[model samples]
Target: MFDVGSGVSANWLRVVIALVCGGILVDIARHGVGPLPFGFAVTLAVACVFIPASPAPLLLICVAAAALTATVDSPFAPGVLVLLPLVHLLHLSCAIAALLPRRARIALAALRGPLRRAAVTQAVVWLMVLVGALVPVGRTPMILELAGLLSIAGIAVVVIVLDRAR
Candidate 1:
C-alpha cells in the first residue's frame, strides 16, 4: 500500500520475507517436523526481518526445506511443490529489502525487472523439478546429484553473464 501520504517502506518487504518464512514453516509442519526444530527455524526467520542483507534468511528456509525433505519419503510430495515458490519469494524479497534503506520509498517499476527475472528463474527450477520427478524410487545416483549441482552453478554463471551484457 504505497499510497501518497502512506508510502511503503523497505520494512514492508522484510515483512513479506518473514511471511514467506512462515509459509515454509507451516508446510514443513504439515510434514510433521517437531516443535524444537520448528522453533529454531522461527528464530532464523525473525532474524531475517532485521538482517535481510545477510545469509540468515536463506539459511532459515533451507533448513526448513531440509527438514521437510528428511521427514518425507517421497520427492513428489505436495509440500515440496508448495515450498519451491515460497523459498524463491523469500529470497527475492530479502534481496530487494537488502538493497534499500529501511525508510526508502520503493517504486513498483523498479520491481518489474527483478520480478521478471525471478519468474524466468522459477520456470527453470520447475524444469529441474520435472526432471527430478522422473527419477526412479530408490537411491539417487551420485552422478545425477553432481550433475544437478553443476547445472545450478551453470545457471548462475549464465545469469550473471547475461545481466552484465545488458
Candidate 2:
C-alpha cells in the first residue's frame, strides 16, 4: 500500500528483489548446474530476500557465474545476457531497499538518479557482452587478454566521466 507523499511501498521493492532472485535461480538451473550447488545457491537467494543488505546476493551471483563457466562451453554464451540483467536488478533493488525504512513509501521521482545510473551501468554491461561475444572461443590470445584489460579500463573511465558530469 502506498502512503501520502510517496508513489510506492518499500515492500514492493522487496518483492522485486525476490523476483530477481528467482530469475537468477532459473538461469542457474537452465545452465544445468549440479543439484548440490544449485540447492545451496537457492538457499542463499532465499536468505537474500530477507537480508537484502547482506553479502548473500554477491554470493548468489558468484555461484551462478561459477555454474555458468563450468557447464557452458562458451564464455560468451547467450544465456549470460539474461544473467547480467538479473544480477544488476538484484543489486540495484537491494541497495535501494536496504536504505529505506522498513515500512517506507517512496516516490519514483526520488529514485530517478539511482535508476538512471543503473541504466547506464547496464548499457556498459551490454556493450561488454557484445564485445565478448565477438571473440573466438578457443585458447585466449595475449591480444585478447590485453583487450580485456583495456575494455575494463575504458569502463572505469566512462563511469568516472559520467559521475563527474553529474
Candidate 3:
C-alpha cells in the first residue's frame, strides 16, 4: 500500500532530514563526541530510509550536523572530524536507497554525477581542515587569534566563490 511517489516529495525529504539532524544533535548533547545510544541510532536509521524521496534535505542536514559537531566537540578530536564526512556519506546512501521505485528497481545510475560532486566537495573540505591543523596555532597570542579569524573569513569567501563557479 506504500506509494513511493507520494512519500518522496521535496517537503517530506526536508522533514526527514530535519528529524534525523535533530536526533543527531540530541545524541551529541547527551554523549558529546562519544558513541551514540542504540535507540537514537536506530531512529536515525529509520529516518534515513525515507531520504531519497527528497534529496535536497540531505545537504541541509549535513551542513547542520557539521556545524554543530564542530562547535560542540573539541577540535583536537581528529577522529570526530574524520567521522563527519563518513556520516554525510551514510546519509547520502540512505537518501539514495529511498529512491527505489514501486517495482523495487533502483535508479542508482542517475546518482553517479551527484555522488562524484559530493565526494569532491567532502575531500576539499577535509583537505582544508588537515592543512589548517598543520599550522602551529597552539597558545597563540590574541593577535594571532584575530589573524586566524581573518583567515577563516578568507576561506569562507573562497568557498563561496568556488561553489558559485560550480
Candidate 4:
C-alpha cells in the first residue's frame, strides 16, 4: 500500500483533474446538453480507464465518489459540495492501500510464511471496510459521505501498514 502522506501529495494533480473534468461533464450533462444521468455516464466512462489501474486507496476513493454521485439527486447535486472533501479523503486512503504487493509476505522471521500473512491481511482489509461502512457517524448526507470516505481510508491504512510490516 502507499503511504498516507505520499498518496495525497503524489495524486494531487490527478485528483484535481478528476474533480474538474467530472464536475464539468456533470454540469454540462445535468443542465446543458443531456442531464444528470448523462453526466454520471461520462464520469463513469472516464473512471473506468483510470480507477482500475490506480492504487487501491485511489480506486476506493474513485469508487466512493462514483457511488455517491450515482445515488445523490444528480451529477454535482446542488447540495453535494460536501462530497469534495470526502472524495479527497477517500483518494488518499485508496492510494495507501494500493502500495501493497499482489502477493503478501510475512514480516516476523518466525512466522509460517508469505501466503498465510497475505491471506490474513486481505481478510482484515475486507473486515475493516465492512466495519467502516456499517458504522454511522451522523445522519446528514455529508456526514454519511465522510463516514464512507473515512472507512475507505481505514482500509487503505491497513494495507499500507500490513505491507510495511512485510
**Residue lDDT tens for model 3, 1-166:** 5444433333433454555555555544544433444344445544554545554345445544555565555664644564466567657655655554434532335567878988898989888888878777667788978998999999999999999999
* Alpha carbon lDDT at 48, candidate 3: 56
The candidate maximizing TM-score is 2
List the pairs of residues colliding in candidate 1. Answer: none
* Candidate 2 error regions (>4 Å): 1-4, 136-166
Better of 2 and 4 by TM-score: 2
**Candidate 3: residue 24 Cα off by (Å):** 10
Worst 10 residues of 3 by lDDT: 4-13
The deviation in Å at residue 64 for candidate 3 is 11
Number of the predicted model whose lDDT against the real structure is largest: 2
TM-score of each prediction: 0.75, 0.78, 0.46, 0.23
Model 1, runs deviating above 4 Å: 1-7, 135-166
For candidate 4, give the lDDT.
0.49
lDDT agreement of model 3 with the native = 0.57
Ranking by TM-score: 2, 1, 3, 4
lDDT of 2 by residue, 59-144 (tens): 98898888888888866677777898898889888888888888788887888898899999999988987887776779899987
Candidate 3 Cα errors over 4 Å, as ranges: 1-38, 50-78, 102-104, 139-166
Q: What is the lDDT of residue 42 in candidate 2?
A: 88
lDDT scores for all predictions? 0.85, 0.86, 0.57, 0.49
Better of 3 and 4 by TM-score: 3
